[model samples]
Target: MVDVGTTLEMVQASQAGMSALGAGLAVGLTGIGAGIAEMAIGSAAVGATAENRDVFGLVLLLTVIPETIVIFGLVVALLLLF
Candidate 1:
Protein backbone atom coordinates (compact mmCIF):
# COMPACT_ATOMS: atom_id res chain seq x y z
CA MET A 1 0.00 0.00 0.00
CA VAL A 2 3.06 2.30 -0.13
CA ASP A 3 3.26 4.86 -2.84
CA VAL A 4 6.38 5.76 -4.85
CA GLY A 5 6.58 9.17 -3.17
CA THR A 6 6.61 7.65 0.29
CA THR A 7 9.28 5.17 -0.68
CA LEU A 8 11.39 7.94 -2.19
CA GLU A 9 11.03 10.04 0.93
CA MET A 10 12.08 7.13 3.10
CA VAL A 11 15.14 6.55 0.99
CA GLN A 12 16.08 10.20 1.10
CA ALA A 13 15.71 10.30 4.86
CA SER A 14 17.84 7.22 5.23
CA GLN A 15 20.50 8.69 3.02
CA ALA A 16 20.61 11.87 5.09
CA GLY A 17 20.91 9.88 8.29
CA MET A 18 23.73 7.83 6.87
CA SER A 19 25.58 10.95 5.75
CA ALA A 20 25.33 12.44 9.22
CA LEU A 21 26.54 9.25 10.81
CA GLY A 22 29.42 9.02 8.39
CA ALA A 23 30.44 12.59 9.19
CA GLY A 24 30.31 11.90 12.91
CA LEU A 25 32.36 8.74 12.50
CA ALA A 26 34.91 10.57 10.43
CA VAL A 27 35.41 13.25 13.07
CA GLY A 28 35.29 10.84 15.99
CA LEU A 29 37.72 8.32 14.53
CA THR A 30 40.15 10.99 13.44
CA GLY A 31 40.00 12.61 16.86
CA ILE A 32 40.84 9.29 18.46
CA GLY A 33 43.68 8.77 15.99
CA ALA A 34 45.02 12.24 16.67
CA GLY A 35 44.83 11.64 20.41
CA ILE A 36 46.78 8.39 20.07
CA ALA A 37 49.39 10.07 17.92
CA GLU A 38 49.66 13.01 20.28
CA MET A 39 50.09 10.75 23.31
CA ALA A 40 53.36 9.31 21.95
CA ILE A 41 54.55 12.53 20.42
CA GLY A 42 53.77 14.54 23.53
CA SER A 43 55.70 12.18 25.79
CA ALA A 44 58.68 12.25 23.49
CA ALA A 45 58.49 16.01 23.24
CA VAL A 46 58.35 16.34 27.00
CA GLY A 47 61.38 14.10 27.44
CA ALA A 48 63.34 15.93 24.81
CA THR A 49 62.44 19.29 26.24
CA ALA A 50 63.44 18.11 29.67
CA GLU A 51 66.88 17.10 28.43
CA ASN A 52 67.72 20.41 26.76
CA ARG A 53 65.81 23.69 26.64
CA ASP A 54 67.29 24.44 23.24
CA VAL A 55 65.31 21.54 21.69
CA PHE A 56 61.99 22.82 23.01
CA GLY A 57 61.18 24.50 19.70
CA LEU A 58 61.73 21.32 17.75
CA VAL A 59 59.75 19.29 20.19
CA LEU A 60 56.91 21.75 20.08
CA LEU A 61 56.77 21.48 16.31
CA LEU A 62 56.70 17.72 16.51
CA THR A 63 53.95 17.81 19.09
CA VAL A 64 51.78 20.02 16.88
CA ILE A 65 52.09 17.78 13.81
CA PRO A 66 49.45 15.39 15.05
CA GLU A 67 46.92 18.21 15.29
CA THR A 68 46.51 18.22 11.55
CA ILE A 69 44.66 14.93 11.77
CA VAL A 70 41.88 16.58 13.70
CA ILE A 71 41.84 19.52 11.31
CA PHE A 72 41.42 17.16 8.39
CA GLY A 73 38.59 15.43 10.18
CA LEU A 74 36.87 18.71 10.79
CA VAL A 75 37.14 19.62 7.14
CA VAL A 76 35.69 16.29 6.11
CA ALA A 77 32.84 16.69 8.55
CA LEU A 78 32.09 20.16 7.27
CA LEU A 79 32.08 18.94 3.69
CA LEU A 80 29.68 16.20 4.61
CA LEU A 81 27.42 18.61 6.43
CA PHE A 82 27.25 21.15 3.63
Candidate 2:
Protein backbone atom coordinates (compact mmCIF):
# COMPACT_ATOMS: atom_id res chain seq x y z
CA MET A 1 0.00 0.00 0.00
CA VAL A 2 1.07 3.62 -0.47
CA ASP A 3 1.90 4.50 3.14
CA VAL A 4 -1.55 4.79 4.60
CA GLY A 5 -0.29 6.57 7.77
CA THR A 6 0.00 9.91 6.05
CA THR A 7 -3.56 9.62 4.87
CA LEU A 8 -4.66 8.96 8.42
CA GLU A 9 -2.85 12.06 9.64
CA MET A 10 -4.55 14.13 6.98
CA VAL A 11 -7.91 12.81 8.06
CA GLN A 12 -7.14 13.68 11.68
CA ALA A 13 -6.16 17.19 10.70
CA SER A 14 -9.41 17.61 8.87
CA GLN A 15 -11.29 16.50 11.95
CA ALA A 16 -9.44 19.04 14.04
CA GLY A 17 -10.41 21.75 11.59
CA MET A 18 -14.01 20.65 11.83
CA SER A 19 -13.95 20.95 15.61
CA ALA A 20 -12.65 24.49 15.33
CA LEU A 21 -15.36 25.30 12.85
CA GLY A 22 -17.98 23.99 15.25
CA ALA A 23 -16.74 26.33 17.94
CA GLY A 24 -16.90 29.26 15.56
CA LEU A 25 -20.40 28.33 14.53
CA ALA A 26 -21.60 28.31 18.13
CA VAL A 27 -20.47 31.86 18.80
CA GLY A 28 -21.56 33.13 15.42
CA LEU A 29 -25.03 31.68 15.71
CA THR A 30 -25.40 33.11 19.19
CA GLY A 31 -24.37 36.52 17.94
CA ILE A 32 -26.95 36.39 15.21
CA GLY A 33 -29.61 35.39 17.73
CA ALA A 34 -28.58 38.21 20.05
CA GLY A 35 -28.88 40.70 17.25
CA ILE A 36 -32.36 39.51 16.40
CA ALA A 37 -33.38 39.72 20.04
CA GLU A 38 -32.13 43.27 20.28
CA MET A 39 -34.13 44.26 17.25
CA ALA A 40 -37.32 42.85 18.75
CA ILE A 41 -36.64 44.62 22.02
CA GLY A 42 -36.05 47.88 20.25
CA SER A 43 -39.30 47.57 18.38
CA ALA A 44 -41.22 46.66 21.49
CA ALA A 45 -39.69 49.48 23.46
CA VAL A 46 -40.72 51.88 20.76
CA GLY A 47 -44.22 50.52 20.69
CA ALA A 48 -44.51 50.61 24.47
CA THR A 49 -43.34 54.17 24.55
CA ALA A 50 -45.82 55.12 21.92
CA GLU A 51 -48.61 53.36 23.75
CA ASN A 52 -48.23 53.86 27.49
CA ARG A 53 -44.54 54.18 28.33
CA ASP A 54 -45.03 51.81 31.26
CA VAL A 55 -44.46 48.38 29.73
CA PHE A 56 -40.73 48.70 29.92
CA GLY A 57 -40.64 45.81 32.39
CA LEU A 58 -42.36 43.42 30.05
CA VAL A 59 -40.27 44.57 27.13
CA LEU A 60 -37.11 44.05 29.13
CA LEU A 61 -38.01 40.41 29.76
CA LEU A 62 -38.92 39.84 26.14
CA THR A 63 -35.64 41.39 25.07
CA VAL A 64 -33.71 39.01 27.29
CA ILE A 65 -35.07 35.96 25.49
CA PRO A 66 -32.38 36.17 22.85
CA GLU A 67 -29.73 35.98 25.52
CA THR A 68 -30.74 32.34 26.08
CA ILE A 69 -29.43 31.58 22.63
CA VAL A 70 -26.04 32.86 23.65
CA ILE A 71 -26.18 30.89 26.84
CA PHE A 72 -26.97 27.70 24.94
CA GLY A 73 -24.23 28.38 22.45
CA LEU A 74 -21.77 28.95 25.25
CA VAL A 75 -22.72 25.66 26.86
CA VAL A 76 -22.14 23.86 23.61
CA ALA A 77 -18.78 25.54 23.20
CA LEU A 78 -17.72 24.67 26.71
CA LEU A 79 -18.75 21.07 26.20
CA LEU A 80 -16.73 20.88 23.03
CA LEU A 81 -13.72 22.33 24.77
CA PHE A 82 -13.64 19.49 27.26
Candidate 3:
Protein backbone atom coordinates (compact mmCIF):
# COMPACT_ATOMS: atom_id res chain seq x y z
CA MET A 1 0.00 0.00 0.00
CA VAL A 2 1.10 3.52 -0.66
CA ASP A 3 2.10 5.52 2.40
CA VAL A 4 -0.58 8.09 3.22
CA GLY A 5 2.11 10.67 4.06
CA THR A 6 4.21 9.98 0.99
CA THR A 7 3.66 13.53 -0.23
CA LEU A 8 1.99 16.82 0.79
CA GLU A 9 -0.53 16.40 -2.01
CA MET A 10 -1.51 12.94 -0.78
CA VAL A 11 -2.11 14.23 2.73
CA GLN A 12 -4.18 17.12 1.47
CA ALA A 13 -6.24 14.85 -0.76
CA SER A 14 -6.96 12.49 2.12
CA GLN A 15 -8.08 15.35 4.32
CA ALA A 16 -10.40 16.62 1.62
CA GLY A 17 -11.95 13.22 1.17
CA MET A 18 -12.49 12.87 4.92
CA SER A 19 -14.06 16.32 5.06
CA ALA A 20 -16.51 15.38 2.30
CA LEU A 21 -17.41 12.15 4.08
CA GLY A 22 -18.01 14.04 7.32
CA ALA A 23 -20.25 16.54 5.55
CA GLY A 24 -22.29 13.72 4.01
CA LEU A 25 -22.72 12.03 7.37
CA ALA A 26 -23.75 15.28 9.02
CA VAL A 27 -26.42 15.91 6.40
CA GLY A 28 -27.75 12.36 6.62
CA LEU A 29 -28.06 12.42 10.38
CA THR A 30 -29.70 15.84 10.36
CA GLY A 31 -32.20 14.69 7.74
CA ILE A 32 -33.12 11.65 9.80
CA GLY A 33 -33.68 13.77 12.89
CA ALA A 34 -35.81 16.17 10.89
CA GLY A 35 -37.90 13.31 9.54
CA ILE A 36 -38.59 11.98 13.02
CA ALA A 37 -39.51 15.42 14.28
CA GLU A 38 -41.83 15.98 11.35
CA MET A 39 -43.63 12.68 12.03
CA ALA A 40 -44.78 13.89 15.42
CA ILE A 41 -45.51 17.36 14.15
CA GLY A 42 -47.68 15.90 11.37
CA SER A 43 -49.65 13.74 13.77
CA ALA A 44 -50.21 16.70 16.06
CA ALA A 45 -51.33 18.82 13.14
CA VAL A 46 -53.84 16.20 12.09
CA GLY A 47 -55.11 15.87 15.61
CA ALA A 48 -55.39 19.61 16.00
CA THR A 49 -57.23 19.92 12.72
CA ALA A 50 -59.70 17.29 13.78
CA GLU A 51 -60.64 19.24 16.87
CA ASN A 52 -60.49 22.75 15.37
CA ARG A 53 -59.83 24.09 11.92
CA ASP A 54 -58.59 27.31 13.45
CA VAL A 55 -55.48 25.39 14.50
CA PHE A 56 -54.42 24.98 10.90
CA GLY A 57 -52.49 28.22 10.76
CA LEU A 58 -50.58 27.52 13.96
CA VAL A 59 -50.02 23.90 13.01
CA LEU A 60 -48.58 24.91 9.67
CA LEU A 61 -45.99 27.08 11.32
CA LEU A 62 -45.09 24.57 14.03
CA THR A 63 -44.91 21.61 11.65
CA VAL A 64 -42.23 23.26 9.57
CA ILE A 65 -39.96 24.04 12.52
CA PRO A 66 -37.92 20.85 12.16
CA GLU A 67 -37.21 21.67 8.54
CA THR A 68 -34.97 24.52 9.57
CA ILE A 69 -32.44 22.02 10.89
CA VAL A 70 -32.20 20.33 7.54
CA ILE A 71 -31.85 23.70 5.87
CA PHE A 72 -28.95 24.53 8.15
CA GLY A 73 -27.24 21.26 7.29
CA LEU A 74 -27.73 21.94 3.60
CA VAL A 75 -26.17 25.34 3.98
CA VAL A 76 -23.13 23.96 5.73
CA ALA A 77 -22.72 21.17 3.20
CA LEU A 78 -22.95 23.63 0.33
CA LEU A 79 -20.35 25.82 1.93
CA LEU A 80 -18.04 22.84 2.32
CA LEU A 81 -18.48 21.74 -1.29
CA PHE A 82 -17.66 25.14 -2.64
Q: What RMSD does each model have against the real structure?
A: 3.1, 3.6, 2.5
lDDT of each residue in 12-34, candidate 1, tens digit only? 77878888998999899999998
Compute the lDDT for candidate 3.
0.87
Better of 2 and 3 by lDDT: 3
Candidate 1 segments exceeding 4 Å error: 1-6
Candidate 3 vs. true structure, TM-score: 0.79
TM-score of each: 0.82, 0.69, 0.79
lDDT score at residue 73, model 1, on the 0-100 scale: 90
* lDDT of candidate 3 at residue 29, scale 0 to 100: 83
Arrange candidates, best TM-score first: 1, 3, 2
Q: Rate the local accuracy (lDDT) of all candidates.
A: 0.88, 0.80, 0.87
User: Per-residue alpha-carbon lDDT of model 3 for 12-81, expressed as tens digits?
Assistant: 7877887798789768989999999999999989999999999999999999899999988888877776
The lowest-lDDT stretch of 10 consecutive residues in candidate 1 is: 1-10
Candidate 3 lDDT at 67 equals 90
lDDT of 2 by residue, 7-61 (tens): 8777877777777788779978998989887897878787887898688777778
Residue pairs with colliding backbones in model 1 are: none
